[model samples]
Target: MCSIWRTLQRGTLRDIALVCLAVGVIGLSYGAVAVAGGLPLWVPVLLGLLVAAASSEFLFVGVIAAGGSPIAAVLAGLLVNARHLPFGLALPDVLGHGRRRILGTHLMNDETVVFALAQPDLPRKRAAYWLCGLGILACWPVGALLGGLAGTVIEDTDALGLDAMFPAVILALVLPALRDGETRSAALAGSALALATAPFLPVGLPVLLGLSGLVLAVGRKRETEVIR
Candidate 1:
């Protein structure tokens, strides 16, 4: 309890709050779309609370809207979220142990991970992670609920440009990582592969194919180290 309070006091509250606001807006867009696509309002609200993965939730809702089978939608969502496997492996210290760890892992989304890692020390990292996670968890569902209700009145979100916000936010998050050479290489390679495969492959599969860029980049680094 004291630890949580201390964590919150570490001066990241404002940043976390801002991120939560952005997430809430995005959640609103998602909920509105889901409702517009004929899903029950409860479905988007539940998915926001439970899934909490923006990209996967969007993909799942899109597949369902397109008349895809539930099994296929589930599989596609899983594939889209598989990037989190590396995120989990990379943040063992932040995750900690026992009961809290379960919640910690569940909260391991892109925003949390990015914010946590940007911190200088372990304490700050954990603090950033928890703050961002909890903030998003709270705001996302509430926004979804409100948006689902509003969907009945507003027929089109695209006119409001909500649809463009998701990718814009993602690009903003990814841009900072490009300052690192290896990350830049990996990102460029992955993006190229994804773009190349976009027309030929199914939606989720291109992302999986893009992951090979990470593998290839790491392998090259290992080979270089061996030569040294």
Candidate 2:
């Protein structure tokens, strides 16, 4: 355990700071966009409470703005963020045992995961926990507040192209992780399915298809590894 903790602390604090900056910028941009999109002031504030993925937060806001029911909105948010479940399951081997570890496991998110996974030589658990914990406690909420405030003052959100930023950020963040053939194929297939269903189904279907795609990617990855 001592060795594990030491290993965790070895990550370059500088790198962690860089990851935090990325998250803060993207999160703040989202809050500003949400407000510019006509979301209530409380919307961005409350979103910070969830402390989940900013991408899912953007999707959740879209559903609410579209007049979707609250139940459907919640379902959509959960579906889009479902990938976190496995992320948590895979975390413990890195995090070790205790209350702080447990809490950190729950807070592990896309940005944190990216930062930690990319640092293959560092203590995986420690780097992951610190990076995510700091981001959750500071970066996201602060960004939201700033963006929300900025949104209130802007008269022409439409002209700013704020709406496109959410999808753009999501793509920029997630696309880099699709390095393998199976993961890329799954994303493409899921996106195709989502597009095909977009005209018929409303809010929730795209998320479901995305989840389906992720599951396929995971299963296919396991199968290929087994063959090797």
Candidate 3:
């Protein structure tokens, strides 16, 4: 406890807690939305445990709400979350090596990455991980509980602009890192490909496009080095 407290102190535990609070409030709305849309409370809770990405959870929830096939829902969810693979791969170096590294990498998700990157300075890698993991665990379960109870109370969250916050927050966390020509192009290309294929494909194409972009990025980097 003493060591953890020191870690949080160096990492500005107050700020991390505030961010987690904000996410918690937002998560309540998510729960309500999911419940209102027809998902059982357990679904979101279980999803929170496994699928750490909000985008993927939203995709899955949307598919189920729309009465889409289960397979389609699964595919769409995977597509939206495929970006995590690269994100996970890239984070280990920053986190260091070994068992803790594995835990941190596995727990790193959209919000956690954003929260960590947002902090210009931090005490230790574990500090960021605790802030993020504890934050998610705190917020999601509470939101799900509230959602179960008050799901019927809220009428139209879309009109209140709460619905837009999720995507905006996720994008805010990601877009800042794309401040380069190659990354920007890759994102655009991947998005375009995904949109183009969405009509004919069964909703898994965005993941495929993202994978393609990763491959392209590697090749492009190699080519640049070769040219140099």
Best by TM-score: 1
lDDT of 3 by residue, 1-228 (tens): 356566555435665676576566666666777888888888877776666556667788888899998898888788766667776665555554787676566567666766666554555545665567767766766765676568766566567687676667657666776887888877777777777777876554555665576567778889999999
Instruction: List lDDT for all candidates, in order.
Output: 0.83, 0.66, 0.68
**Per-residue alpha-carbon lDDT of candidate 1 for residues 1-228, written as tens digits (9 for 90 to 100):** 457557655446776777798889877778888998899999989998888988888899999999999898888888878878878988999987999999999898888988787776898889888878988999998988888888855556678786776567557666777899999898789889988998987666777678888988998899999999
Model 2, which residues run further than 4 Å from truth?
1-11, 95-98, 121-124, 152-228
Q: Considering lDDT, which of the candidate structures 1 and 3 is the better prediction for this target? A: 1
Q: What is the lDDT of residue 87 in candidate 1?
A: 83
Per-residue lDDT of model 2, residues 1-228, tens digit only: 445345554444555565666666666767887787688877776777564567678787777778887787778777767667766665555555788776666567765665555555547646555655665658777778787887755444457665565455456556666776777899887888888886777554565566577777788889989999
Error of 3 at 56 (Å): 3.6
Give the TM-scores of the predictions, in the order they appear. Answer: 0.82, 0.63, 0.68
Worst 10 residues of 1 by lDDT: 1-10
After TM-score superposition, what is the CA distance of residue 154 in candidate 2 from its true location, in Å? 7.6
